[model samples]
Target: MAVYVQRQLDRQPERTYVIEGDADGYWKLAQSLIHGEPYSIYTPPRRVLRMPGFPFFLAGAMSVVGEDHFRVRLILALSGAVACFVVYLLGKELVNETIGLIAAALTAVSPVMAGFSVLFLSETLFAVTMLISLWVLVKLSKVQFRVEDQFQGRLWSVLAGISLAVAFYVRPSWLLMLPLVVFILILSAKEHRTAALTRGLLIIVGFTVMLVPWVYRNYQVTGHFVPTTLWAGPSLYDGLNPRATGDSDMTFFDQENVLNSMSEYEMNQHYTKRAVEYARQHPGHVFELMGAKLVRYWKPWPNATQFKSFWVMAAVSVLFIPVVFFAGYGAWVSRDQYLLLLITVGPIVYFSLIHLIFVSSLRYRLPAEYSLYILSAVGFYQMCFSSRQGKELNPE
Candidate 1:
């Protein structure tokens, strides 16, 4: 993938520079952390810009390894390796170590998850943020009514909130995580008494603090106080509707490029209003879209590429025929454990809402897909264990 991105850059560095900034604004607010110098927004090919956090993360990696494109790709690969381990941590907390190992192994191999590891993108960043959030959630869920541990629960819950807030920074859609946080607090209240409330409040406070600066910056420049990326809603509306005219092969970014040229500021204004009005006037369309996108979320499989994401989808479909049922069984068997369901349901609900309300992007669906794998691993690892009980294994 680095080879591909570098080749594109070599051929037309001019096109890629726009990713660093656009006509709207610069990263002036977050500049100290993300870039070594005050840099203008440059257009990165569709591949790199999708992962905004990648350049910053990889820039650090480049500083250590030598400032080159290979360094960025190397860093992405390494972060992905670490992210798989993080998924293992989540799986271990949700199920058992065997499940954890299985989840990690699958993460390393899964086409969708592994595919992003090659780009200078934020898919890897988003994955790390989300997995860390889940891991922190699992820790905070263990919070109990030990009054003496007030500070402990508070700290853990704050950490969890910070994790969630960071995820939103990495991928703005993660803001939807608060609904699940609400459920977790309510469920935990009975067990932990007032500390649960304290935990919840602390979590909210933490997230608010983390999110304030971005909101303030948006307010400063745009006067609207948007949270993350400014373009997603209007971009999605135009990209998916009749206006985009993208074929099945084109990506969300490709459609956006053409739409960006064809449409102007006034069009985005119109599209924004129309998107809201459409959702209001035709609520059924929203539900229909949600269902369709959810299917796409699963069907085309995660590891789609220049050569194929649909074929990977087919393979996953065949593999998951039994995987889903076993997970349903395991989840049913673990019915009393809200942790399992909370982890499973949060991303699904969040992404479904994003798809229905906003524009659909394959990358937008990533966090939810990876979250599902932990549960899938529960079934896969368990079946592998049960079917092979008492059987001897040979080391390779």
Candidate 2:
């Protein structure tokens, strides 16, 4: 909290453009939402360029606090705190209380996480929402689906779906996780297949209920049934163009000059077509690009060009090495706990695959990074205190 407060006070004068174009875009979007006007100041008025979750939250904070940047940072700082708490709960649920405490402590002081809290980006909020969804899914996986407990199990599944729906609103990429989660539930509840299917149906119902209004709003404005945000095509093309360097490049779209004359939907279609054509024409280059993207997504250092100090980047990169090592060891040791392994590894896999097709950056990997803390805690506990009895000293 003190760190966040100090950073906010130090940077308060430049709050309006702290993160440059992205932060300014979010601020404009929030103002439009608060005023009940179209979100055109940043993108096309007819299309929703960005997801609505963080802007809505920021709009509420702005309304209550009278549009002050410090107050908004305070809200995000609170979210970072909540993310730490959620990591603790997730670690406890997966292993034991000791592991939970360790994970929470690491998350509380993580440089990447802390840096995000002081900015007006959606990464903090998205991390919190993703953690909440994972915690709920962990609870659901543990539920015993007896005939008498079917209602309780169904309720838990629905709640997990609702949490994930909130996460999807924050970052539409999470929508890809729905089927994966449902499959996991089905596999875990193999003894009661019918009950598992019922729970899955209820989850889908809950998710659809939460998502309908957003879809409807997009359709009404754009005259098309756009389920997610309208930037998918451009985002995909950003990584596929000939000048692509495994990081985001906005120059292709600018060079095309489609923004001035085309509708948002048309622009999206054009970009999609262009990216697909590129992939078709240069299959080997596409494969090489994906390999580079995987490296960028998982590399331990901050890859953004703004972090110019080599020594500082190397120091931060070194910090992540221990976490990565222990997480891999923890995953290997806990391989028998299939559901636990899924909970820890699912987000990493999901995000990696998505970024391979789009752009890869540290910011895009933030939501999954905390989950590694859970595995790291387990590894730390096992290495430091495991006895020769082949039993955990602090079993849940």
Candidate 3:
């Protein structure tokens, strides 16, 4: 892990120095956090347009290391290393230690996973938070939900909720996962109705506690209640507009130049209304665009045209195909284990549905990739060892 971090630091300037416009905003936001200055992105009102978690994370790193570009990359690399360990824990809790190690190894070497860590983006931190949340839920699954276990089960549920809240702060779309997870927990503990209800309530409480402050801050800034960041409308429009081409293209709005004059809230409303009208007028086209997005979401290569390096793209495809094949086999073999299946397969399915509605890209698909590692490990173990042992690990 240390070696990986070092290599990333060495290549930081050449490999990861190209900051996208969105990333520039985040970097400036972190700088503002550090220097206590008013920061604006796109235009004035200078509010919390993006999620706050990653900016705060960058701020902490900059505070310690004086905001050097390499230092920021180092922080992300170390975070990636931590994610690898968290993947191990998630795998071990779901299956066995051998699977855990295998998952960790896959995560460490995955081209997308490793590359994301060195880039100035929120995906790495979001992935780590997501894994931590899953780890907590996996632990909670083992609890009996009996009277004796209620207190401990509630604690684990709260921790899961808190971790999920952190992830939500990193990416507002994560908010979609909360209810689905709660629903899974309810179904998993159907026999222990009282305990399940209590656990669910506690989890909601924890999540609400984490989110309320941010909500209040947004209200203060915008003079209206906003649950998450301000980018959702633009993001939605980015995928649904007439010129979407089944991927994110900010030029649709940029060409009009109306967003420049509007406040963030107004801009969001304008784009959202336009996107909805477009979808209404062109339902067949909307479906076609969604189909294209689904394909792009699962494609192994770089989704953007600029990053399409032939050899690198080929290598990613080579690595991704087998892992996905093995992962599918593993998911099939473990189909009977409800809790394990939910943890391993739920995010991929859920996020796929999300992209069907919004936008799709490799970067958008990353949070669920850790779960794929877990499934791939299971597939490898089943192919190599389960047959020899003549038994399967029961996910009770």
Candidate 4:
């Protein structure tokens, strides 16, 4: 196990540095953000938005070890170590120790997730923090929920919220899980409404407290009241940029395409305006885009695995649906039925919104991936140990 862990840890730095260079926004963004400078508009020059966690960690690493390859690689390897444990804890809640081990094993050697071991990407921090958040929720939801344990739950939930706050800090799109967490509160509060509501409120309160400072910082920088980061408008621009020149997968329904022949930013506004106008003008395309986006997000491509990074991600996303559905359905039939609904609804709604509008990238959805994996493991558990005669086996 030690050798395996070491090997996995050693493999990441070279690949991450190669794919996302050590210079440019990938490395410098961390330095800039940590020094309280302006966030890079295009760092790593691909999809890695200037998230909060990776740069901070890398900066800390730089302080200790200097900006050498050895330092960054070492930090990422340590990051992977924690991520592995988190996967185990998350998997343990859904199934047995064996499955927890399997899940961790999957995370440890996962060609996809293994990158966390080396690269200073948002996915690693997001994955680990998300695991902590979900594990806290699971631990708190037991029938033996005592006052002390409930207090502990409160503490953990607040901590989870902080972890999630860091997740959003790592990648703004992770805000999708916030709604899901809210759904858990709604479902959790059904039976113990007052207490659950109180806990839920406290959780949100904790999350809000953590988030406001960064938002205030963004507001100060951009002269706008932006609650999240500063990439959405530009990202929206990218989607429509190519569309105007017969390059996008989306087709224009009206003069909007013709008008979009302006600057990139101008074309973005045109597409945004037209999407709303066209939705009103042609509700069919809106619905079609919705359906089509869902398909685009899931449907396989030819020789997809060649883009190994995206290929594995698409498979993970597809598998996640089954995991969530089975676990969600099973939980609904149990005593803690509300948790089932909460677990399912918030994340789904959040994911649907992002998957629809934004460009579909694997890393974009990394935050919620842990939740689905946990839920899936639950589904796997229920499948392996079926009720001999309508009997449910609670792992507790």
The clash numbers for all candidates, in the given order, read 18, 0, 0, 5
**Model 3, 69-92: lDDT tens per residue?**
766778888999999999999988
- The candidate that wins on TM-score is 2
Clashing pairs in 3: none
Model 2 whole-model lDDT (C-alpha atoms): 0.82
Off by over 4 Å in 1: 1-55, 65-67, 191-193, 239-270, 281-288, 300-306, 309-326, 387-396
Model 2 — which ten-residue stretch has the worst lDDT? Answer: 39-48
lDDT of 2 by residue, 34-139 (tens): 8998765644363578888988888988888767777777777888899999999898988878888999998887877887876778898998999999998888
lDDT of 1 at 152: 83
List TM-score per model, in order.
Answer: 0.76, 0.93, 0.93, 0.69
User: lDDT for every model?
Assistant: 0.61, 0.82, 0.82, 0.57
Q: Which ten residues in a row have the lowest lDDT in candidate 1?
A: 42-51
